[model samples]
Target: MTAETHGDRQLAVRLGELLGPRHPVAAAAVVTPEGTHVASRGTDADADADFDFEIGSVSKAVTGLLYADALTRGEITTDTRLGELLPLGDAPVARVTLRALSTHRSGLPRLPKSAQPWRRTITLWRNGTNPYGETLAQLLLQTRDVPLGTPRSRYSNLGYELLGHALARAATTTYSELVQQRIATPLELDCFYVPVTADELRPTALHGRSRRGRPRQPWTGEGLGPAGGIRASITSMARFTAAILDGSAPGTAALDPVAPVGGGARIGAAWITVQVKGRPITWHNGGTGGFRSWLGLDRNTGTGAVLLSATAASVDRQGFALLAEHSLSTGNSDSNSNSNSNSNSNSNSNRR
Candidate 1:
């Protein structure tokens, strides 16, 4: 008889504690600028490091990266109005700037008005529904002259959906195609924007479970792809996070905070910045049906991490703990020394 490997036992132990018997196979990964570590708490020979899971709202930050890269390429500025890119017509939302949408200051609601009582009840129960079936044409038709709240950092899926579409419009490509061309290609990530009629996903897509441990429907619908349709393996996310922290990612500019959202949280294009033990940490979390994911970076310490789970359990707390490792004094010392080394190198080169 073959004995279980230490990693497998550890995963079993951790999942046993975190899930308390409700566990559906889960995985977590930590990706620092210099290294990466991954652990699996459940077993599935088919679901190795390459198995992709829906990242939910974490797609917003990915969209933010696309926005920042667009700005870098001089395609559009943050001040660009939504109407300038999309065919919003004379809708009041046409006046909202891409900046406002990226920072969630456009005053758009968390979701469209169409998602109704069923959405509320199902979400509360984690029943999993494809709440985003409205196509781009439908989305534009739904826009009205409804007044919005004052500009501030309020989470808005609708705003991001529009923002992604606008960015794609500016690039003359579909949202998924833009992501693949700009972000995934540069970083060599295996992630993809999964559409609702995704026939290719049947073999790899993991079934999501409701909070009550019942299996739920898969999250699909191409219309909502911009807001929350991307999926990737834990390792792929880790690699992406590592790239962002090191400034190699095209969307690196998205990590810079653009506006404060009170209580010490600042909003970037779509990423949120918070302080942990006095070091700035940029992060975003996502959840859909039975999946949840997180991406975080600490530019000051040149380190970052990602947490991806196949269950709907929020990974925010685990993300915070792992990401905070960079805030420790040791990590800062290494960063300071590296900064000094780089400064000296630059000075010597200048002398020559």
Candidate 2:
């Protein structure tokens, strides 16, 4: 068998093994100098590469890119306060700086307070409905009464929600439009999008399931788009990872580590850099009520991996192992094999 075919088969097998006995639908991809390798586990109707999955907080990584791009365009600065762009009035959140927001040091809670988050959480657990379906205006109103805690390196979905909208406002556009015009269109990620409501989801969007196999509602809302509302197909994720690795993605500077985030890791905007297998791996993981996802990249090796599962389960370890294995296995392949494989993969990706 051809080496490329053999490699593809091996990757598929490994993905299946890693997934093992759980998760009704999942997709994975690895990018190397020899190009992208993709695999999925599901029935014929749902296994296509174009099937969309909610990416959850990985949306923050995209928002991070936008934040850095805004900085470059002179539309915002690290010190820019929320009040400068968003209508937060004299609220404590309005005084938070953009840099602090990006790095999760803005002292905002995990979810908007105006949404009656505690009750929503109970409703989500009982009814499998979305807990973060607040509108942008609702989110802003919610922030008005939120008391800020001491700023530290804390993860906050609310921080990103505001940061993204503030960045969009700085550019004189809405957050969804900013994402479309800047990242998705420029990268040709046809299925990459932020849905403001459940009805906006494409037909191919997969229904995620809870751990006990209960169907969960799609997490979509105007206020949540920057935090956990974005969705994309596996192919789009693969292409996005490739762009990030090659430094061709806009706002690549967002991946540079700027502050420590404990556990010997550093934060770069929304991305996290941690030591894994003795190499610096920049990554971000996400989970909604129904889905879980992980994306990791070793820029030094020019290798990256992404895992998307329709069930709410951890995939971080599997993602790291996949990337490490791919990096090691292809580290010394001959130039001709690498060229041929990369050509094939790139051609197929472009055709999609």
Candidate 3:
């Protein structure tokens, strides 16, 4: 119903065209300074607004929110090191600053090499195994062996995981609790951390599918939730992004670019920044065993978009394209409206 009205069908058509038939089930939304619009595909008779899928690394942005909130409260500074927050022993990562972790510059690898990541990848592809079963404690144990490189833009899931854990420790709570209380509650979002399987998300979790549309294992596990554990609907994300652009969200400081990510792209806390049509856009994307998601915003125009899909194929190019188009549209509409107002006023003066 909501998807059937309010430009939902039009947005859904655009999404469908971008994804084609590969990602049959998805939801996309655009939020402007004016209001929010939502659309969904393959959600026919069995889903509600709360229905959603894993948001993957977009969870990094959530972690970034927690970090920013703490920063504002003087709980932690950008310069705070991991060792000061958690009892990380002598791991090289212990010396890394919170800022570095947030920006993927802590020199940590994408994951602990000892985890046999390649094996896990093969198993996941062949049989849909939940490869991230290692708990936080175990993951910590493996971190000592991770060679810390010079701070640069290396995408590290392990870095965010550690950062989330350390931030939780700083707040005297678990990562899941920290996210719920600090970010979700403050923002009034219905999002859930879903440490493992969430019964609520089950009724609507678009059955995880592979690139070929074969059923794949849903990405649910402990420990990795901090790194990629958030589950939410398009509406939920749309509202959240809207909050960030409107200045009501607590963690938007995370969007402040800290270092160059690559080739003219800069990285904020967990968000990646790039110029789209001459306007700066900060965004992040995620993929699990069976889900793909993206969130982006054009702060210059207070416009944002979120795209979530049940299939593992990426929608990065499409997501960026859509956000760019909307960002440009918002600018053009403002200029055109102003021109029209002036034209009408001049016409009225002549008639008078």
**lDDT top scorer:** 2
Alpha-carbon lDDT of model 2: 0.80
The ten-residue window of minimal lDDT in model 2 covers 343-352
Q: Give each model a TM-score.
A: 0.84, 0.90, 0.89
Model 2: residues >4 Å from true position, as ranges?
1-8, 46-49, 330-352
Number of the candidate with higher lDDT, 1 or 2: 2
By lDDT, the candidates rank as 2, 3, 1
* Weakest lDDT window of 10 consecutive positions for candidate 1: 343-352
lDDT of 1 by residue, 1-352 (tens): 2212123354335434444444456666665555666665544554343567788888888899889989989899979999899987788888999989988889876655655535554564553544555677877766554457787667777788889999999999888788878777878887554555556463556676655666655666555667787877766777787778677888677878878877767777877777665567777878776677777777776667666666666656656655564434337443321110000010110000
Reference-based lDDT, residue 129, model 2: 88
- Candidate 3 lDDT tens digits, 1-352: 2233223667878877777777777888899877788888776554454567788878888888788888898889889999898777787878999988988888898888898888888888788766786677788888877879988778788888889888888888888789778767777777555555444355556576777776766666556777787788777788788889998988778898888866677777787777654567788788887888888888988899888888888777778777766776887743221110000010110000
Report clash pairs, candidate 3: none
How would you order the candidates by TM-score, starting with the best?
2, 3, 1
Q: Whole-model Cα lDDT per candidate?
A: 0.67, 0.80, 0.75
Q: How accurate is candidate 1 locally (lDDT)?
A: 0.67
Show where candidate 1 strays beyond 4 Å: 1-23, 47-49, 117-127, 200-202, 326-352
